[model samples]
Target: MNSDHYTYRVTWSAEDAEHVGLCAEFPSLSWLAATPAEALAGIRSVVADCVRDMSAHGEPVPVPLADRRYSGEFKVRIPPEQHRRLAIEASEQGVSLNRLVSAKLASGA
Candidate 1:
């Protein structure tokens, strides 16, 4: 797996008082540095090393999020009352429940 293809994020850690780099595919791995660039570089190097180690050990390496396929469909369970409320809201808005829920999710609500 190419570490470059993996999803990476760098953000400030208030508790650590430094920038923190994170890889979505390797949730347990992180690198803290004084700067975002250093943090990102550190995390990338760590991921590359991990990938190499896993490969050498005959372990399955994770597919990069950028290279993975998503179906765009998933099931979510909510309480019956909440479901009924959403259904009514959808009906009042003249849209399907899926559409209403999709809008809400897209809005980050």
Candidate 2:
């Protein structure tokens, strides 16, 4: 398997006093090192080993999330009171509820 097909991220960990590498596809594994490069290399090595083991056992490996397509739409459920409040606020702002909610969500508010 090509390691480049996976997403690898290295982030600083204050609690560990080092950089930690994590693979989004393999949530169970992580690696730590003094530098981001070392941490990423360590995780990639681990992923290589895991791929080999899975291949030998005929286990399915997850497809990379980066390769997937996403629709811009999703559904969310809210309490009745919260829904009413949002509807009122949207009306007051002269916008559709969907537009108001989408704007708020996009702004991280």
Question: Relative to the true structure, how large is the alpha-carbon lDDT of every model?
Answer: 0.98, 0.93
Error of 2 at 10 (Å): 1.2
lDDT tens digits by residue: candidate 2, 1-109:
6767899999999999999999999999999999999999999999989988988899997777887679978999999999999999999999999999999999999
TM-score, prediction 1: 0.95
Clash pairs of candidate 2? none
Off by over 4 Å in 2: none
Residue 104 CA displacement from its true place in model 1, Å: 0.5
Which parts of model 1 are misplaced by more than 4 Å? none
